[model samples]
Target: MNPLSIERLKVFPPVSNLDPSIYGPQDSALKEEQIICHLNGMSVQQAIEENKLFILDYHDVYLPFLDRINAHPTKKAYATRTIFVLTDMGSLKPIAIELSLPEKNRNGPPKCVVTPPVDATTCWLWQLGKAHVCSNDAGAHQLIHHWLRTHACLEPFIIAAHRQLSVMHPIYKLLHCHMRYTMDVNAQGRQLLLNAGGIIESHFFTAACSMEVSASVYQNWWRFDMESLPADLIRRGMAVSDATEPHGLKLLIEDYPYATDGLLIWSAIEQLVQAYVHYYYPEANIIESDSELNAWYHESINIGHADIRHASWWLKLSTPNNLISILTTIIWLASAHHAAVNFGMYPYGWYFPVRPPFMRRLVPNERDPDYTTFLADPEGYFLASLPCLDQMLHYISVLDILSTHSADEEYLGDRKDLSAWAGDPEIVEALYKFSMEMKKIGKEIEKRNGDPNLRNRCGAGISPYELLLPSSGPGVTCRGVPNSVSI
Candidate 1:
C-alpha cells in the first residue's frame, strides 16, 4: 500500500464491545492474561510502523474499558494499573499493562506521568514556535530553524537583544551585568534568561511583522509612552544646569534666544537618563550634584534669570567627557526613539529637541507637514540609527565580559574610572565613527529636504560633537564656539 494510504489506517482496536467471559475471575490475573498474549503475537516495531498502537495513560483506557465491560450485562471487574495498552480491533482486548510504583506513599490524586522542568533549550524552542506562529513568515521560520541548528541554542542572540532594550530604557548596564553574572548561575537562572529572551523575541517579532503592513502599524506597536517622562531628566539634569550656568554671560555676549531652550534640552536629556537609572538601577545613589542642579533649574525658571556665563565658563565645565556623556545619552535615546517612530509612535518626532525643528521645517508647512517622505523611507532612518545601535551593542558586550569577573573593581573603581570608560579607546572610537556617520546622514537628510534657504538655519549646520583630545591627565578640550552640536 502507498505510504499516504497506509497513514489513513486506524491501527488501534476499539473496546466498546469487549467480552468479559474470556478472562478469569480475578481482575489482576485477567488483565495479565489478556494483554500479555496479544503483545507476544506482535513486535513493538511492527506496532509502530503499521500505526497499530496508541499510547495513553492507563486511567484513560481503563475507565472507558470498564464502562464497556459493565454494559455487557455480565459485568466483570477491571484491573487497576497506571499504564494499559489496547490492541486487536476485530477482537477488543487490553493487550499490555504496567503498574506504577509510587516513590513515596502519600497522595490525594495519582499522576500518570511526571513532567520534567523546562530548560533553556525548551524555552528557546517555545520562543521559536511563538515567533513563527506570530510572524507566519516562511523566511522567519527558516531563519529561526537555522539559528537553532547552527548555534545549538538561541539564548545568546535573545539575551543580546534583551540587553539592547535594557540600555534603551533607563536601566543601568551594570545591574543587567549583575543579574546575568551573579544572580542567575544555575538552571533556574538560565531558564529565567530564556524566559526574558522569549519576551523580547515576541516584541521583536511583533515589530518585524508590523513593518510589513505600514510604518504607522510598526510605529503604533513600538511607540514609546509620552505620558510619563524619563527619569534621566531628574538625574542628568544637573549636567545641563552646569552647562547653562554661564547662560547669563552667553546672553550678555551674543543675546542668544535659545539658551533657555538649550537648558530645556539638557533637562530633557537628564530626564531620559533618570528614566534609565530608575528602571535599571533604582538602588543607585542620587548624587547631591543632581539635586543641586534641580534646584538651580527651578530657581532659574522662577526668577527668569541665569547667572555668570562667559560661554567659556560653561565650555570649561562642559569638558569633552561631559559633552561626550551627553552625546552618548542622546544617541541611546535616539536609537530607542527611532525604533518607536519606525514601529508607529505618534508625535513622530526625534527624541532630541534640536532635530525636530529642522525636521519640521523640511516639510512644506510646519503645522501640517506631510510625513510621506519620512514614513516612506524608514530604511534610511533605520540605517542612520544603526551606528548608535551598534554602540549600544558594543557596550552590552563589554558589560557581559565585565560581568564574568569583577565589573566594579576592574572598570568602576572610582568616579574618575567610571568617567574614564567614556573615553576608552574602543568606546571613543565607536562614538567617533557614529558621529561621522550621523554627519553624513544628517547632510543627506538636509539635502533631501529641498529647502536650500532653510538648510543650515535649523541648527543642522552644527558640527558633529567630537572629543577634542583623548584623556590626558584631567581636563577635557572643547575646540569650537559650542554653537552647533550634532549627536
Candidate 2:
C-alpha cells in the first residue's frame, strides 16, 4: 500500500506561482476544443447535454504529466489532483445522424461537417458531467486500477467530480506554511490543486447507473460493514418477496423506472459495485474490458468482493445484454451491501466517520451523545445548515439527492465540506464540455465500423428495412424482450 503523504498531493509548476501562459492549450487541441464548447452555454449542464458525448472505453485520457493517479510521484512537487469533463456530443448519435460520407469516386473537397453547431438538436440524457478532481490521486488511481485489472469499472463508465467549492489541500498548506518562498507560489499552486479536486468531486458524469466517484462515500462507507448485512438477505432477486410493486408505468416513466418491482435501489447499487470492480482493474484486457465482463456475471459476483472471474455472466443471458445486466447488477450489490457491511446502514453521505490511525485497529466508535451531534435531516440540522439560510428541504434534500447536494455541497463532501470553496460555474462548464472531447476516439471508431446489424432475436427475421431510412421503411422495435431488467 502507498503511504499517504502531503508531498504526493502537491501541484507542479505552481500555475498559481508561475504564469498561466506557461501551460498553453496550443498542443492540447482536445483541451482547446473543450474550452471553446465551454464558453458557449449558460450552464455546464446545458452545454454538455447539448453536445451528446459518448466515450470510447478503450482510450486512456489523463492530464499532461499524469501517468497514473495511484502511482508514486517521481516529480519533486507531487501533483495530487486532476479533473474530468464529459459532453453528450460525439457519441452514438453521431453515428446515427445523417452526414455526407466521403464518396469513393469523388476525391475533391468533401463537404461533410466536422461537428455539429451548439443548438437545441441534441440528446437530453447527454448532459454534462460535473467537474471532478482526485486529491487521493494515487490511492484512487490504485483502487480503480486494481478493480479494473480484475474486470470492473468497464461495463459502465466510471464517473466522479471535484468538490463544489475548491480549497487548498493539507499538503499544499504544509509546503507553503513557513513561506520562506514567495506567497505567490503557494497561492497559485493551491488554487490549482483545489480546482482539480473540485473537478474530481464533480463526477456527475458517472453513468447514472454507476455513481462510483464517492458521491455517496459516507453512505457507502457506513453501509460497507459486513456485520450489518442480514445473513438471510435474499442473495439475488429484483426485490424482497414481500415488497409491494409500484402501481403504474406512469410512476416509472416519471421516475426512472426499473423493470424489477422493488429492485430500484437494489439494481442501482448492484450496477455500481460491478462498476467499482471494473474501475479498479487494468484495461487492454481481452476478456473483461473487451468482452463486457463476460468473465464474471452469474457465478455470484460481489462488489469489493475479491474473487476470480467466472464465465457464468454469459450463461445468465444472451451476449451483450448479459454483459450489461451482470455489470449493472454488480454496482448495486456493492452499494446495497454497503448498507449491510459498513458501519452505517445507509451510506452516511455527509456524515463521515473517523479514520483510525491503523486500518487493522479500526473499531467502531459510537457517536458522542455528550457533545452536540448533527443530523442530516429536515429538522435538527441547520435550516441551511449554516444558521443563515432557507428551510428544511434545502438541507435534507441536498443530502438525499444529486440536485440538492450539488446545489448545497458536493466538492469536499468526501473528507470535509469543500463544495462552498470549489463552486465555479466556469469550471463546471469546462469539465462537462471536457467529457465531450473524451468521446472523440469512440465516435471515430463507430464511423469506421458503420451501423450494427439490426437483429430480430425473437424471429421477426431479416428486416431489410434497417438499411432504409424512417421515411423509406418501417421502424423496428429494439432487440430482445420488449422490456427487460438485469439482476
Candidate 3:
C-alpha cells in the first residue's frame, strides 16, 4: 500500500479552498494522535508547516462515482484517503488510510469507515482495506494520469499542430518528432482500450465509472500551466518556490527519483526549447506576426480543448519566453512525463497482487455472509477478493504490451535526421546539444539508481526506478522514455 516515492505525496488538505461539506467525509478516520506517533515527535501542524505531511487523496474524486461503480456484482471500490509522512530517509511512510463508502443520501455520514486494524482479524480486514485503496489508485493512475494527462489532453495539440502549422514551419519541425505515433496510439485507445465494455471498463476497479471519473478529473483538476515539472511540484505542495534552490524550487523530499531525475531532463528540454524558439523568433513581434503559429495556438485552445477554452491557466503565446515555456511543457509531457507513467507499468504491476486492477469481493462485514468465511481463513478470503485468473491474465497482457518498446522507438533525443534541418546551423547545434544532454541525464539516472539511500529506487528487493532512463533497445526493459505515447 506504500507509494513508490514521495512524488505521489500531495500536501495535506490540498490547496483547494472548497467548503468542507463538498468533501466525501468531513471527519478523518485516521486521527491526529494516530499520525503524531508516526511523525517522529513532530506535531501534525509542524509536519504541515514543514511540508512533511502528504496525502494520496482519492476521497472526494472517487466518492461521487462509488455508487455506480459498486453496482456491478463482482466489482467493488472505495473512496480512500491515505496520508503519509516524508521520513528523514526521504521515503514516504503511509501512516493512515481512510476507506469510505457513500452515504445513502446527502444527509448522513459515509455508510462505512475503515482504518488500521487493532487485532489479528481487524489486521486481516485492514489488509482488505489497503487492497481496495490500491484498486482505486491503479484505476486513477491509468485513466487519469496516463490516458488523460499524457494521451487525451495532448491530442488536440497534435491535431492543431498538423492542421495549422505547415510542415516547413519551425515550430512544426520542433514539435513534429514528439508528435509521432500519438494519433495512431490515441485512435487505438478509443477503439479498443477505452471502448464500451472494453479492457478498461471490464478490468479496472472503477469499471463503468472509468471514463466518467476521468472526465471529472479533467474538468476539475487539469491545468496547462501545471503541466511543467516545477509548476506541477509547487501545485502539489511537494515543493516550495525558492529563488536560491536548484530548479528554483526546494523539494520537500529530496530523494524523489522521478522528480530529481526529471528536473534534470526538464531543464535540458527547456534550454533546448529556449535556444530553438529564440533562433526562430528573435523578437517578440515575430511571434505576434506569425499567422500559422497564432492559428495553431488558437485551434489548440479554442477548438481542440474547447471544453476548457476559457480556462484561466492558458498561457498567452505573445513573447519568445512564453513560447519557450509552452514548447518545453509540450515536449516534457510527450517524453519524460508519459514515459514515467507508461513504461514502468509491467515491471511494477505484472504481479497482480502488487497492483491489482480490480477486486472481486467487497470488504466482508458482520452483516454479510462472507464475514464468517473471512474469519476462518482470512488469507483464502483475501485471495478470493482479487481479480479472477482470466482477468489477471488480461490485465497483465495489456500492461506487458503497453510497457513494451518497439525497435524503431524514438527516444527523447534520438533524432538522426539533423541533416534535414541543416538549413539552420543554430537549430542543428541546439539539437546536437540536446541529444548529448539526454545521454548525460541517462547516465545520471543509472548512478542514482545505485544510491542505496533512495529507497524507492534502490534496495534489496526494490526495482530501480528506470522509467525515465531516456533510452532503451526494445521490449519491456522497464527503462526508456519514448518521444510520444506510442502505446
Candidate 4:
C-alpha cells in the first residue's frame, strides 16, 4: 500500500530530512508514542531523520465529502490516516491509523481523534477500522492513482502527438507502439467505468463522489515533471539522489520491488531514447529546427495540459537532452507506470478482506446497536460489513478483466514492426537493443523473486511482485507491462 497503489501516501513531510516541501504540511493527529514503540530501537525522530516514516493521510481530501458520502443509505466511510515505519527488512509496517468524522462546526478540529480500538476484547473493532481504511485506499487507488494519473493525463499527449506529428516522423514512430488502443480503451472507460452510476460508483467507497475526489487530487497534487519514476521517488522521499548509487539515487527501502525493477526498466528506456535522439538530432540546432517536434511539444503543453502550460517547471524542448527526457518519461508512463498500477489489482486485491472496495457499515461505538451484533458474531459482522454478495462478485469480475492480458497483447519491447524503422538501420538496432534489455530485465525479476533475502517478494505467503515483469501470457497472470493502457 505504498505510493504505487496508494499514491497519496506521501512521506511525512514535516519530519523529512530531505525535500520537506515536496508535500505541504497538515495538522497531524499522530503522536510520537503511537509510533516509537514499533521503531525497532530507533527513536521516532531518528526514523524521520533517516527518511523512514511515511503516511497514507486522507484527512483533508475526504473530510469535506464525508457528510454527503455517509448520507447515502448503504455506504459509509471515514477520513483516515495510516502511519508506517520502514522496517530494517525494507518493507513498510503499519504502526497506527486514525479515523475521524467531520468537525461539528466545519471550521474547528475533528471532534475527537478516533483511533483503532486497543483493548484485547475489541480486536474485531480494530479489524473493522482497518477495513474502512482499506476501502478508502482502494477507492483512491482506482480513481486518482490509476485513472487520473495514467489514463486521463496521458490522453492530451496522445491527442497532441497525432495532431502534430506525422506517421513518418521518428518521434511518432517511437511512440506509436505505446499509443496503441489508448483512445479506444479510454473511450470505453468513460462510458462504463467512470460514467455516473457506473462500475466505479457501484463498487468503490467514494460512490457518487468518485470523480469529485479525483478532480480534487488532480487540482492539488498532479504534476507532469514528478510523473517520471526518479522524480516521483525523490518527491515521495522514497529515495534520495547520490552519485555513487545505482541510477544515481538510493532507495529508502532496499527491497522495494517496484523501485528496484522499475529503475532498471526506466534506465533501459532512457538509454534507448538517448541513443535515438542523439542519432536524429546530433546537434541542438537540429532539435531546434524540427518544426514537427516543436509543434508536438508546444501543443501538448499549451493546448492539452494548458492549466500548467505556463508553469516554469515545464521543460523546454530546444535541446536533444530535453526531448529525450520528455519522450522517455511519456513512454514510461504509458507502459511501466501504467502497468505497475493497473495490472496488480487482482493479485493484491482479489481477496476481498485485503482490499474491500466499499464498506456497508461503519465501525460501531459501545452505545450503538450494531456493537451488540458485532460482539455476538464478529465474523458474521465482518462479512456483513463488506459489500454484499452481488457487489463482491461485481468488483471481482471487474478486477479480473482489468488484470487479465489478451492473447495478442504487445508487451514493452515487443515491437512487431521493427521493419517499419528498417530505413534507418541505427534506429532498428536501438530497438533491438531495447528489446533485448527488456528480456534481461524479465530474467532479473525472476531471479529476485527467488532470492530469499528480499522478503517482500520471496517470503512465504507473499506473492512475488511481477506486475512490471515485462511479459505474460493471456489470462489474469498478474504479470506483464503492455505497450499501452490497453486494459
Candidate 5:
C-alpha cells in the first residue's frame, strides 16, 4: 500500500553546551525545560504526573581542534527529555527539551511519533479500516481502501440518479409490463399443459385423432387395448407409442391468427435471431443481411407476406446458416400459440404499439383486460396449440443435433495434425460410439414415422428437416385426418 501522510512536526536538539555559538542560535532556544512544557500546553507538574516525558540520548562527534580550544568544551554526547501529549480529540502533539550533559556513549536519536490525519467523516474511515482488515494482500487492501473512500462519498447521489433514470427511461415501463404479462401467461400455460390432471387427456385425444380416422382407429386400438391385440402387432405398436403428431394447416391457422398472432411470433423470432447472431458473430455478414430483410419488410405494407415467406425459406434450408434462424422462428411461434390459448386472442396493437388504449390499461393496480374477455371453448384452442408445442420440441431436437455435429466437426478439425492412431483413443472411440448410437436412434425414429426418406440428406448426411415428421407413438398415424370443420 502507498504511504499515507499525516499532520506532524519534528524537532532536533543540540548536544552538551559549548557557549551555544558553535551549535547554532536555533539550538539555544530549544534548551529550556519551561519552553517544552509551555509548547505542549502543560505545566511541569502535569507533565510529570502524566508520565508522558522521556529522556532520550545519543552520542555525537565535533571537530577535535575546535572542541579542544573551546573554553566551555563541547561534550561528546547529550540527553534530552521528550514530552508527548495528545489533545482531547486524540491528535498527537509533542515537545522536547535538551538537558545538556557530558556523556561518552548513549542510545541513538529519539523516535518521532507520526500522527495520522483525522477524517471529518469517520464512517468512511471506519469502512476503510474494515476493508483493510478483510483484505488478504497489500494490493487488495489498497484497492479496497480506495474503493470504499471513493464510492461511499457518491453512494447517495448514484442511488438518486438511478431512481430518476428508471422513471424517465421510455422502455422501462413497457419492458416491465411485457415481462409481467409473459410470466403470467407462462404460469397459466404450465398449469394447463403440464399439470397431471389438467390437459393430459385433451392432449392425448388431439394426438390420437390427428391422423386419418381409419388408420388412427386401428393404430390407436393396438396401443390403447394392448392385451386384445396379437403379440407381434402389440410389440410393434409399443415401439411407436411415443410418436408426436404433425401440425396441420387447419390447426396452424386456427391457433395463429394471421394479422395479430402470426405477426407477433414472426417479429419476435426475427428479433431473437438477430440478437443471437449479433451477440455471437458480430463481424459476420448475417447481421447486415437480417437488417436488409427487415428494411424490405417495413418498406411497404404490400410486401408483408413476401417478408414472411422469405423468412420461412430458411426453415427448409438444410445448411448451418439457418440453424439459429429456424430454431428461433419455431420457438417464438410455439410460445405465441401457447400464449394465445391461455390468454384470449387480442389485437396486435394492444400492448405493443405506443399510445394504444391497451397500454393505458396496463397498470400495476389493474388486471390485464384481455385475460378477462369471454371466449367460447378456450380449452379447444389450448388443445390445438399442444401440437405446436410438439413441433417446437422437434425443432429444438434438430438444433441439438446440429450443435452436436458442429462441435464434433470442429473438434476433429482442430486435431487434424495428429494421426488417427496417435489421437486419444478414448475420445475417438467416444465420437464414433455417439455417431453410431445417433444413427440407430434415427433408424428407429424413421420406422416409427414410416418414412424411408426421413433424415436422409440426398445420401450425404442426416437432414434437420426430418424432425418435422411426426414422432412415433400410438397417438400418431401414417396418414392425416381431413379437417371435419372449416378453419
Candidate 6:
C-alpha cells in the first residue's frame, strides 16, 4: 500500500460557515466573524436539508464535538472552538468552568466539568482559560488572564440551560427552542455550532480507553472483569506484584517464542470477540472474566465511551441474566412512541441522555490498586491499541447504511466474473498460502501431552529459523509441501 496515497479517516472537514476557504491569518477572532456572517444567511429549511449546524457557545456542543475530535484529532484542529466559545466580556468571570486548557496534555485539559448559577439572563463573557465572567453585552474587546478554573463534569449544567434556547433538533426532544429563537437567530446559531465541531470538546473516549488500559495493567489486572486467572501473570511473565523482578507484556514479546505473532493473533481475536459480544449477544459482558475489566472501564462515569458500548456493558453487568435477548428488538425503534409525539418525531429516550435507566442499577466500586508493591514496578499504566473501536466505527457506518432505505443496490456487479479479477491475484495467493501453511502451527498451541519440556517449548519463543520448516500432516496442512513460495 502506498502510504502517501492512502487517505486516513477525514470524517469532518473543519469549516468556517461550511467553507474551509475562510481561514485567514491563523487567528481565531477573524474566523468567528466569518462564521457568524455565514450563519446569518441560514434557514430552518436549510438546516434540515444539510443535517448539520455550526455549534454556538459552550453549553450545547458537548459530545457532538467530542465525536468530531475523535474522528480526526490534532492539537491545531481541536482548539479552534474554545478560542471562539470562551471569548470574554467586561472583565467578569468567564462562562466556562475550565480555567485554562493546560498545554501539558495533548489529549485534553483534564477529566472534569464545571457548574454555576447561570440562567438565560446571565450576561457573561469569556476570560482567559476555561473561565467566564459577567459582561455588558459588548463583544470581547480584550483578554483577562485572572479568571479561575473548574472541572469538566460541572460545566455542562449552565451550558445545558443555554443550549435549551438554541436550535432544537426535531428528533432531540429536550431541546425546545425558546420563542426568542426566531427563524433568523436559530439558523445563524446552528451554523456556528456546525463549524465549531472539531473544537469545543476533547476526544474523551480515546483518552478513557488509554487511561483504563494503563490503570488496569498497572494494577496487575484487567479490572473490567473480576476473574481469578493466572493467565494475566503467565502471559506477562510476571506476578501481581513485581517482588520477583519478572518482566511484563513488553518482555514477553521480546523474549518469549512466537510472542509477537501470538500477541498479534490474540489482538485480532480480542477485536472479533468484542464485536461478537456487541452485535450478536448485544447485552453480554464478554470480557468480565478478566477480573479488573470493569474497573478500568470506569463504568460509573457518563462520558468517554460510545453509548452503545457503555449500555451493552451496563445491561450485562447489571442483569447478568434475563430479558437480554428482548432488548435487541428495540434497537431501531426511532425513539419509541412517546418520543415521536414529544419531539415531533419520536421521543429521545432516557437511554440517550444523562440519566439512562441502567445508571441506578450500577453499584460502582472504584478500587485503586497499589502497584508500588510490585518488584521492579513499572512507573506508569498499560495502554492497549484501540484498533477495535476504529473497526467498530466502520461497523456502525455500514449498519447505518443498511438501515437506510437507500441501501438496496446489489453490492456486487450483476456479473460476478467481471469483478473476480479486480483484486490483486498475488494478494489472494498470499492469503491462501498463509491459511494452508499455518494449520499445523495452530495444533501446537493446543498440544498437551503432559510433558514439561514440550509444554515449555510450546509456550516458549518460536525459533526464527523454523518459520518455513516443512512439517508432516495427514492432509490437514501443508504436509510435505515445497517451500518454493516466497513470503
**Model number with the top TM-score:** 3
lDDT of 2 at 416: 28
RMSD (Cα, Å) of model 6: 28.5
Write one digit per residue (lDDT tens) for candidate 2, span 292-393: 233223213332232322323223434443333444333332222211111111122222111100011100112324113322231232111111223223
* Model 6 lDDT, full chain set: 0.23
Q: Report RMSD for candidate 5.
A: 38.7
lDDT by residue for model 4 (354-388), tens: 68988988777676767788788888988888888
Tens-digit lDDT string for candidate 3 (1-487):
1222134443443332334565434655556766677888888878887777877778767888877787888887777777877888777777777767776633123544555667999798878878887888888788888888899999999999999999989898888889999999999999999998999999998888789989998998889998899988887767788999878888887877778888999999999998998888999999999999999999999998899999888999899999998999999999989888888888887888757888887777787777799989999999999988988888899999998999899998888667769789988989999999999999999998998878888999888878889989899898898887788
Give the TM-score of each candidate.
Answer: 0.16, 0.18, 0.94, 0.92, 0.17, 0.16
Whole-model lDDT for model 2 versus the true structure? 0.23
- Model 6 TM: 0.16
Order the candidate numbers by lDDT, best to worst. 3, 4, 5, 1, 6, 2
Q: Backbone clashes per model, in order?
A: 23, 100, 0, 0, 8, 62
- CA lDDT of each prediction against the hidden true structure: 0.26, 0.23, 0.82, 0.82, 0.26, 0.23
Candidate 2 similarity to native, TM-score: 0.18
| Candidate 1 lDDT trough over 10 residues, lowest sum | 1-10
What is the overall TM-score of model 3 with all chains considered together?
Answer: 0.94
Q: Which parts of model 6 have CA positions greater than 4 angstroms off?
A: 1-45, 56-271, 275-487
